[model samples]
Target: MEDKELKDKLLLSKLKAEDKLKDRILHQINAEQALIPKKRKSKRASKENYFSIFGIMYAVILSLGVYFYSQTEKNPLESNTFVFSVIFVAGSFSIYWFLMVYMNYKKVKQ
Candidate 1:
């Protein structure tokens, strides 16, 4: 009976220690979470988005202008307006995608 009582006490102490450890872990998690600031979501990307769009529009217009100007010349086949336009758009989009992925990875790592 004495041995059984000792075993019961040991089990009780073990359970209490586990509960304390769990509480400590939860407290630490909450404390760490409180230290980090959350990012505010913007409802719209107005200014930057608009300017990026305008820049793209301007590029397309400029490319068209170049293409037309080349058409009036005798060496129309030598003009690379279309190729440059394609390269510019592809490069811009790929860069944007890369930046987005990098930003997301950073956010997740944090």
Candidate 2:
């Protein structure tokens, strides 16, 4: 019937208009995203860089500990204390780094 045809045409027009509106909104969102500045490094990459730096620091501290231990004959108590302190610092840094890695892993998992 003509009435049914008119209703179908009206429904089709409504759908087309809705599709156009959706496209417009999507374009606007994309345009806004384009205008935003991108970060230089992602979170994972920066974290990796930080961990590498910590690794280097750990190696240096370890070398110093060995050197101090080697020189312990001159002043045993002083050298022991210095070596102990270095060991404590290295342990703390390692624990903290592992905790950070675990936290990142959990975050990624979620």
Residue lDDT tens for model 1, 1-110? 69999998888766335668988999999988865543322213333554575577667656766766666754433457655765676677557655765665576568
- Model 1, 60: alpha-carbon shift in Å? 8.9
- List residue ranges in candidate 1 displaced over 4 A: 1-79
lDDT of each: 0.62, 0.69
Q: Judging by TM-score against the true structure, name the best candidate.
A: 2
Q: What's each prediction's clash count? A: 0, 0
Q: What lDDT score goes with residue 65 in model 2?
A: 64
Worst 10 residues of 1 by lDDT: 38-47
| lDDT tens digits, residue span 25-89, model 2 | 99999997864433222365547856785887688777776767687645434665776877777
- The local lDDT score (0 to 100) that residue 21 gets in candidate 2 is 92
Report the error of model 1 at residue 22, Å.
Answer: 9.2
Error of 2 at 70 (Å): 1.7
